[model samples]
Target chain A: MSIILNHVNYIYGEDGPLAVKALDDVCLQIPDGQFVGIIGHTGSGKSTLVQHMNGLLRAASGHIYFNGEDIYDKDFQMKKLRSKVGLVFQYPEHQLFEIDVFSDVCFGPKNLGLDRREAELRAFDALRKVGMPAELYYQSPFELSGGQKRRAAIAGVLAMSPEVLILDEPTAGLDPKGRDEILRQIKELQVRTNMTILLVSHSMEDVAEYVDRIIVMNKGKVMYDDVPREVFSHYKELEKIGLAAPQVTYILHALKDRGFDVDVNATTTGEAVETVLGALGRKGTYI
Target chain B: MLRDITLGQYYQTESVIHRLDPRVKLGGTLLYIISLFLFRNFLGYGAAAVFLAAVIGLSHVPFKFIVKGMKAIVFLLLITVVFNLFLTPGTELVSVWKLTITVEGLRTAVTMAVRLTMLIIGSSLMTLTTTPNNLTDGMERMMRPLKVFKVPVHEVAMIMSIALRFIPILLEETDKIMKAQIARGADFETGNIVKRAKALVPLLVPLFISAFRRANDLAMAMEARCYRGGEGRTKMKPLVYEKRDRLGYLCIFVYLAVGITVGRLRF
Candidate 1:
């Protein structure tokens, strides 16, 4: 019930002069029901790593195992793997092509050989989970607003009922409010379904607030993998690679540098608030 | 995988041919194609091959890269060869499974293959050496006389260059769309022809919509910049004929004259 990678390496344009090591000797294990955030700068192999999880991109070397089965085995069914580990690509709204949002969401389940009634039911449930209004289900996906379209696209992957869900930058190109809505829905989904969730994101604030564990990647290699607070504690090193900890982490550290007794390891704004109040010996008075 | 398409892609290099005027390269390509039609014998073919080889050498573009462009036209080459191999009337060489093979048919097939190969290689050479901007400038300048006859030369050139520029962008878009669909369990491979064509609906619909959206955005951006349909538009890097351009023209005319004479001579 876990996904494991062993010494995975992926090289783009292999053997050519422009060869780029997109993923370099990476190894990781994601257990069941874990919400993990993968954060990296652009071209840091974040997308490449997620694609490999679902067997979409084959590693040039090493192995991937899903639920104790070697995915690269000759007898392994890739379609089955894809169904169990659903991936929502970046700008997924662009992949919606059905005349209506409901039909588009049913596409994934139908591909799994589900009957019409069952597929429609799954689509209905999935859309509801994403908080897409029932009236918008029959509307053309193309006519939906950007945030709505994005939610519908997420529902498209959700209909498959994957054991593990991977979203690559799902909140990209959304307004701040829309971004919060999507992340909240995703957090609720993970809690309700108890599915292993891998959220690839660029925003440290969103990842720190939502995910339980964080994986920091830089230059096609894993730089740090730990709880959000532990990973953000290396914020100075993270900044050296064009990435930063959440703003709250920096604020807490600045407070600590000014001789305050605040816990500088807090990774989110709420945690920082509690830490600051406790440090000022006024924790119960703030409420 | 779409990036493998080498047609109309410039190969960056510091070489004699790369530095030549785009107009000279364009005219040379036209003359080369015309010479292919004029040639009727092996001697003319040999002369053309020599000229092409020399040009390719001077361009500094790898021969393998130029040959990669030929992979796209292999089917057309096969069709031409097959038609000429069996349909031409001449002395009978052999009969295989109800089809007659003749001496004239063999000769025509071989000659057609050679000519077609040379034509593609020659044209691709020009594009490989010159950027699309330079090619557009060359065509617009060369077609200026057409303006008197109501031909919007500049507009036509602008459209041509824009289309060329969009090829790579559209290719990248297609790649992304395909991957996204595949993630949704949309199988594009491992299907029969009709099923495969049906599978493309998901891909094509999204691609068309995105392309239209991009086109709309580009149009608005151009309008915002006050674009007015190529009227009195000036280039920042105007085309200028250098000394090497003159030498290039001289070499092209000499090859053309020699090719025509060698082609007309009886074997």
Candidate 2:
């Protein structure tokens, strides 16, 4: 019940002058029911790697296994694998082409050969899960706000009842409030459904607060794969590749440098505040 | 699978053909196509094949890549071959139950196939070697004379260049849309032709919307930058005819003359 990539290598435009080695011998195991965040600078192969998880992009060499079975096997049903491992692309709202939001979300379950009634029910359930209002389900997706449209697009994917959901920059271009709402709903979805979620994002703070693990990529290679705290602890190395830990991690580090006995490993603001208070109380110092 | 499409895709290489002025390449390609029609016999086609092979070799583009482009037109080529083999009125060479093979039909079929192949390759060479910007520049310069008749040649060229620029981008967008839909279990491969096209509705509607949105954004950007019609627009890199262009023109004329002379020869 895990997605395993074994020595995967993928190249775009092979042998051409524009050839790019997008992924290089990437071996990773994504355990089921875990919230994982993948972060990297642009063009560092984060998108390419996620696409390979469900057979969207075939690896040039090596293999990807879903639930201990090689997906590339002749007998494997790729369509089923895709439904089981749903991928929502960046700016998912642009993918809404159906006339109404309800029908659009039904596109997924309908494709899975579900009856109209079952598909609609799934769509409604998925929409509810994403916190989309019931009254807006019949409205045109284009009529929705940016954040609403994003939620609707997510509902479309969720309608398939995928065991693993991979979102590429789900909160990109959203305001702070919308970002919080979307991320909170995603966390709740993972907890309620016990579905493995791979959140591909650039927002270190959001992922730090939500995801259990972080995988930092650079130049088509995994530079760090650890829990958020450990990953942020190597913020110096991350900065070399045009990446940084959450803002709170930097603040904690700065405080430690100024003679404060604080844990610089804090990745979120709340944790940093607690660590700072603990350090102050331990030292019996007045603020 | 969508990414396999290489139409309007540029191949960058430093060669004599690549260095020639875009106007010369455009003229050469036109002349080459005209010469292909002038060739009625094997001798003329042999000259054309040699000319085309020489240009392709000189261009430094991989032979396999050009040949791959041929794959797209294989169906049309097959239709032409089948039509020519059976439908042409000529001396019967082989007679089956319902199909009759003719001697002249076989010859004409092969000739037509060669002509079509050469035409596609010649035009592909023009696009492959010349950047879209250069192609647009060359086209605009050639059509400048038509402006005297109140033709919007510059705007037409700008539109063409923009369209050319968007080919790859649209292809990438199409790929993304297709994958997104496919992830939802849309079966594009298994269905009949109509069903397959119906599947494309999900792909195309969004594509058209995105394309229009992009065009709107581009128009806004251009207007923001004070882009009026191509009136009084000075070229940063002006089109200057060089010695290589002249040499290329000479080669085109020589190739056409050879093809015409070969066509005139009997036996």
Candidate 3:
């Protein structure tokens, strides 16, 4: 039930003068129900790696196994696999074309050959899960606010009932409130469905707050793959690649550098708050 | 998958042809195409071919690259060849079952093929050597006389240039929309004509909407930047007829004169 990539490599504009090695010898595994965050600067192979997951892209070398089966095998049904593993590209709102919001969401399930009634039911359920109001169901998606359009787009992917949901920068180009709302809903979806989620994002803070595991990429190679705390511990290395740990991690690190007895690996604001409080408690200033 | 298109594509090279005034290249191409039609015999065709070969060699454009454009017009060339080979009346070269391959038909087919090829290569050479912006600039300059007739020549050239620039952008956008629709389980393949056209509804609706959005954004951006329609606009790289451009014009004139003379001479 897990997806495994073995020594995958991909090149763009292959064999031409402008050829680029977009991905190089990358290997990783996403066990079912695991929340994985992939972070990298632009052109660092983050999107290239995610595209390999659902067979949208083929590897130049190596193999991808979905639940212990080779996806590229002669008999493998790619369309079926795509349904089981849904991909929501960045700016997902741009893909909405159906006249109404509900129909747009139903497009995915209907494509899966679900009955009309069943597809509508799934679309309604998905829309509710994304917190879209029932009144907006018949409205044109184009007329919705930016946040509403993004929610409806995610609902479109959710209607497919995919076991694995991979989104590339789901909250990109959103206001702070919109960003937090979308991330919170995604977290709730993962918790409720136990679906394997792979979120590709550059914002270290967003990744730190929700994902159980963080994989950092740099120049077509994996630089670090570990738990959030362990990955954020190497803030110096991450900064070299134009990445950073969550801002709280840096604040803790700054306090530690100034001779405060605090754990510098605290990634989220809550963890940093606790760590600083504990340090102050040890000094008998609080409590 | 739409990225394979190389239309309106410019090949970069440090050569005299690439540096020549785009006006010279445009005028040279028009004159060359006219001369191609003027060729009535082997001598004229030979002169034109040699001139084309010399210009191509001087241009430093790969021979294979220029020849690649010929693949697109292959069907048209084949039809022309077939019509000429079967229909032109002359002394019979070969008589078969209800079909006569006349000597004139054979000659007409060969000359037609040669003419069509030279025409494509001649125009492609101009585009290959000149960038789209420069081509637009040159065209605006050339069409300046039409301004006296209230033709809005500069605006027309500006629109053409903008359209040329948006081709690649729109193509990339199309690819993205296609992928997104595919991810949503909209099958673009394995459908009958009606089904396929219906499927295009999903792709086209989004594409048209995005295109309109892009157009609106571009209009707003132009307004913000004070891009009024082609008035008081000066070129950053003004077109100038250099010594080499004059030489290019001279070469084109000589080639046309030679081709016409060889065409008329009884050899």
The alpha-carbon deviation from the true structure for residue B162 of candidate 3, after best TM-score superposition, in angstroms, is: 1.1
Question: Best to worst by TM-score, what's the order?
Answer: 2, 1, 3
lDDT for each residue of candidate 1 in A76-136, tens digit (9 for 90 to 100): 9999999999998888655899999999999999989899999999999999999999899
- lDDT (tens digit, per residue) of candidate 1 on B136-250: 9899999999999999898899899989888888898888888888877889987899999999999999889888888899899999999998787887888888889999999
- Indicate whether candidate 1 or candidate 3 has the larger DockQ: 1
TM-score of each: 0.94, 0.96, 0.93
Better of 1 and 2 by lDDT: 1
lDDT of 3 by residue, A235-285 (tens): 898899899778898788789989889988887788888999999989889
- Cα deviation at B96, candidate 3, in Å, is 5.9
lDDT of each: 0.90, 0.90, 0.89
lDDT: worst 10-residue window of model 2 chain A: A88-97
Q: Summing lDDT over every window of 10 consecutive residues in candidate 1 chain A, give the lowest-scoring window.
A: A278-287
Q: Model 1, A111: alpha-carbon shift in Å? A: 1.3
Write candidate 2's Cα lDDT for B1-267 as tens digits: 876655556789898888889999998888888887876578988888899899999999998887876788899999999999899888999999999989989888888888898898889888889999999999999999999999999999999999998988888888898888888788778878999989888889889989999999999999999999898999999999988888888888888887899876887
Task: Give the candidate number with the greatest DockQ.
Answer: 2
Model 1, position A274: C-alpha lDDT score: 84
Clashing pairs in 1: none
- How displaced is residue A230 in candidate 1, in Å? 2.3
TM-scores for chain A, candidates in order? 0.97, 0.97, 0.97
Q: Mind sharing the TM-score for model 3?
A: 0.93
Could you report the Cα RMSD, in angstroms, for every candidate shown? 2.2, 1.7, 2.3
